[model samples]
Structures are given as C-alpha cells and as structure tokens.
Target: MDSGFDLVSGGTDNHLSLVDLRKANVTGKDLEKKLDEVNITVNKNTIPGDPQSPFVTSGIRVGTPAATTRGFVEEDMKVIGGLIWETATAFDTKAGEIRAKVAELCAKYPLYE
Candidate 1:
C-alpha cells in the first residue's frame, strides 16, 4: 500500500526534513535544546523506517513558514541559528533561559489574532 504522503520518486513530501541522529551524530534531544535557545520550536520525529516510539524519536522536524509569518526574515534566521548552536552545545546549562526566551518570542509574534 502506498500513501499519497510519499512522493512519486519514493521521497517524502515535505519542504524541510530532519536527518536521522544515528546518521548525523546529533540526537533529537540536542536539536530541541539548540532550537530553544533561538526561540525556534520543533518537534521530534521518528525516522522513516524506525520502530522506536514516536515520543522518543531521534530526529527533529523544523518548519520555517510559521516563523516567517511572524515577521522573521533571513537576518532573524542567523540569530536563531546562533542560539540553536549555543543551546545544543550547552543544553543543561541553557534550557531554562531558552524557554523564557521562546515565550518572549511567541508573545512578540503571536500565532493567532
């Protein structure tokens, strides 16, 4: 059975996708930490062929359109990128601070009217 979710060439139909942690050496936990630092919210996902539980997957999926709609541009992406690097590099030391920052960012660019 083939779901339409899969592309014609057997690829996934998505604009942005996450690489598997086992293949990339970066875990979803680490990715979440880094994204938080820059106020980028993301959800962890299971690898395409993995049998692991979805709640504890090894990949992080990112969507940029939401941020863009909230007025984020390329320059903002640079700032977010830096923060992601820092948070991932120092997860334990930065989680709390990053959470607060994420909250602030959301307030600045609320999702709904």
Candidate 2:
C-alpha cells in the first residue's frame, strides 16, 4: 500500500497479500519474471474482476512465511517492499541495485544455517 500498489480484497488478514498491478502499468507475468530475474520469487494471480487471463494475471501474490522462516523482520520487509516497488516501476534501470539489496538480505540470514 505504501509502495503505491493496490491490495485486492482491500488488505490481508493473514500472511498473504494480493497485489493488483493495473496501476503499475505492468502485468503479473511481467513483474513476476522481472522479480525472478532479480531473485525474488512470487506467484502470478488473478484479482477480482481481472481482465487478463489466469496465466497472465493482473496481480501477484506475496507471502511472508518463507521470509519469516529465514528471519526477515518488519524492517527488512519494508526494504523489500520498497525494492518490489522499484522493480515494478524502474526495473530496467534499477535491476542491479535491486539484486544487490536482495543479496544483502539473504546474506544477513542464511537460508539453511
């Protein structure tokens, strides 16, 4: 929300957040690929009234369980949210910087330590 993205169903009461990508002028397919290129994993999803097909959705589902298991705190999530916004808005220009930040976070909490 703070990152200028809309949440489908208003907001989440649990660990998942469904981000509508219409306002960002990108498709869930595009953003998912971009995020993946930068090492961020997310799933494409369809929002209520989505005009796009399920395979090329207008939204992406973000979840916290994996990050939480890796020891990501709220502050780290804020940075990640900012990174997601950057990836969605200026991916071509900020991909390197975004990847670096992601590496820093992953290094901070090793996945299999």
Candidate 3:
C-alpha cells in the first residue's frame, strides 16, 4: 500500500490485492507475462477508472493465500515480493534465475508431498 500502487479498496485486509498499474505504465497483460515467465501465477483485472479492455486490463490481481496455506511464511513471502519486484523491473534477464529460485522455494514446502 505504501509503494504508491493504486491498490483497490485503498489496500487489502485480506490475501489478495488489485494493483492499478497506470503509474507503472505497463498493462496487466505485460506484467502478467513477466510474472508468468518466472512461474508466478496472477490474473489481469479491471480497477476503478481503468481505461483498458478486460482482456488487456490496466491492473493485476495478486494474492498469497495459497502459498501461505502451503506453509510459506513471512520470509518466503518476502522472497516472493522480491521476485515480483524483480519481474516488474528486470524480468527479461532474470526469468530463468527467478524461476529456479521459485522452484527451490516451492520444493522446500512441497504441496503434494
């Protein structure tokens, strides 16, 4: 909420958040690609005042409830945050490395094991 992102509902009191990306100037489609390249799943969504189509929304919705339910703690959340920020800033060069790291983290808390 403090990162200047126009978060829906002013901010989240739950696991999910809607991020308005007009300031980032990157559509949700582009941002979604970046996150997916690193194995992070997210969905594009519309926010208040969004001027883009739903399929190419100007916002992205992200959440951590699944990871948390799988035993990921705050430190893991922090790492995920860094990965996401890295994606936002420099995903083209870091996709492979970030994906590897995400795999490693997920392996540590295997969901099916």
Candidate 4:
C-alpha cells in the first residue's frame, strides 16, 4: 500500500495482495520472473478486465506469510514494498542491486536458525 504500485482491489485485509502492473509498464509474467531471479517468489495473476492471457497475466499476487514467519516486521515489509516498486519500474537496470539487497534482507532472518 505504501508502494506506488496500484493495488488491484485497494487495501488488503490478509497476507495476500494483487498488484496491477499496467501502470508499471510491465507484465505480470515479467515481474514474476524478475522477482524469482532475486529469490522473491510471487505468482502471475489475472486482474479485472485483464487483456493478457492467464499465462502472461497483467497482474501479480504477492503474499507476506513467509516473510512474516521469517520474522519480518512492518518496516521490513515497507522496505520490501519499495524494492518491489523499484524492481517493477527498472527491471533490467536494477536486477543486481535488488538481488543483493534481497540477500541482505533475507540474511537477517535465516530460515534454518
């Protein structure tokens, strides 16, 4: 919500949120793949009145349960939201930097211990 991206249905009440990628000038598939490359997992989803096929959707579904379980808090999530925006807005140019930042963030809350 704090990110500049447009929330498909506006404020989410759960761990999941659907992001409309039209304004970001990127496809759901594109963002999903880019995020995956940086170790952030998200799924391509079709938004209302979607023009693209389900395989190449116009939206993405992001969930926070895993991050929450890993001990990420509100500030961490806000940082993540900013990272998502940066990734969407500058997919090619910011990959390496974003990846490094993601690794740093994840390292703070190791999954194993």
Candidate 5:
C-alpha cells in the first residue's frame, strides 16, 4: 500500500469504500462538496496515520456500484457525476435540491425487495 492509501479490512463488499485523503491533494470538505453536486454520495473519513482526533476527518470516499446494481446505467452515472461536480463547486446553494434529486433517483431503483 502507498503511504497515503489504507486498505479496508477484509475489503469492501459494498458499492463504495472510504479512502484516506491525506495522500491526495484535496481535502475531505472540498471533495464532499464536489461529490454532492454530481449526486455522488460519500463519507468523510479520518486518516489512520494522522495524530489528530479521528472524529473529524480530512478525506472523502465515494462509489456507485450499488446504484449501478439497482439499475443505474452510464447515463445515470453521468448525471450523478455532474451533480457531484456541481456540488463540489457550489455546495451551499445546491445541496438541498441535489439531495432531493438523489432521493428521487434512489426511489426509482430500490435496493431490496
């Protein structure tokens, strides 16, 4: 593993995995904002190597396999990507609408029976 990347224990079985951002040039806050605009949902995580408190993190990780399994195709991915990008660029103004849209999309393709 690289100095910045920490592998998830047992690997990830879900559509997404959390990645530490200390290695990357971006911050969790910035990445979160960007991902939100494109409809990509991700969680902020703490860098394992950090000496600071873990409660607040400096990394954001995102994935879309779950949505894909739920019937999201390339077009959906594009839409999601756009939303994420937008959110990253302009978070405060677009967060609510983007969240609502994400909900609507999720409703269209439920995860379970």
Candidate 6:
C-alpha cells in the first residue's frame, strides 16, 4: 500500500479499505475500541488468511462515506486518517487530541443545519 498500510487484497478499488494488522500485533477489536474512544468509527474485519476469531479479528474496515455525508471532503478524510493512526498507535496519549480534532471536524461539517 502507498503509505505502507497492510491492506487486504493488496489494495482497494472502492470506498472501503480493509487493513490487515496482524504484523502490527494488534487485534481488530482493540483497534476498533481505540478508534471508538476517539469517535473514529470503524469495524472489525476478517482479512484473507486471518487465523483469529471474528470477535478478535486481525483486521479493521474503514470507510469515509459517513463523514462525506456529514459534509467532509478529501482533505478532512486525510486528517481523520492521521488521527486514526495516532489513536491506534497510542490510544491513551492521543485520545484528548484526536477527540478534539474530531469535534472540530464534525462541527465544521455538521449533520444538520
């Protein structure tokens, strides 16, 4: 993958991205929990060749449709991606910062007028 992300099926041709995190030594459930803690919604996924249970998957599924629906654009998605990465790698230390950023983004792109 471009940024060295461990992607499933090698790459993506759609809106959704399936990230294999086995080599990272992290579980999808933990990653999802970390993302959720900072308001970055994501779902656990079963990547090809995954050897873990669904409840403790080795991958995560991330998409930007909901954010786009809330008025987010390409740049915002990039920012959110960075925040997600930070939170995934260092949840406790980056929670406040990521949450604040997510709040700012959501406010700028509110669901309703």
Task: Give the Cα lDDT of each candidate.
Answer: 0.59, 0.93, 0.82, 0.91, 0.62, 0.82
lDDT digits (tens) for residues 13-63 of candidate 2:
999999999988999999999999999999999999999999999999999
TM-score of each: 0.53, 0.95, 0.82, 0.95, 0.52, 0.87
Q: Residue 33 deviation, candidate 6, in Å? A: 1.1
What does candidate 5's lDDT look like per residue over 1-113, in tens digits? Answer: 22334434424566665655554455676676566554566876665565435555665566766777799986776666556544554566887887787888888888887
Least accurate stretch of 10 residues (summed lDDT) in model 1? Answer: 1-10
CA RMSD for every model?
A: 8.0, 1.0, 2.1, 1.0, 6.5, 1.8
**Between prediction 1 and prediction 4, which has the larger TM-score?**
4
How far is 92's C-alpha from truth in model 1 (Å)?
1.4
State how far residue 15 of model 1 sits from its true place (Å): 4.5
Order of models, best lDDT first:
2, 4, 3, 6, 5, 1
Evaluate residue 33 in candidate 1 and report its C-alpha lDDT on the 0 to 100 scale: 56
**Candidate 1, 13-105: lDDT as tens digits:** 554545454433456766765675555787777777654567666666656778888887666655554455445555568777766766776
Compute the lDDT for candidate 3: 0.82
Candidate 4 per-residue lDDT, tens place, 4-92, comes to 88898887999999999898889999999989987889999999999999999999999999999999998999999888888999868
| TM accuracy, model 1 | 0.53
Q: What is candidate 6's lDDT per residue for 45-85, written digit by digit as tens?
A: 98887899988998999887898788788788778767766
Which stretch of 10 consecutive residues in model 3 shows the poorest summed lDDT?
1-10
Model 3: per-residue lDDT, tens digit, 1-113? 44446677877788998888787677899989888878898898998878998889998998988899889997887787667666776677888888999999999999886
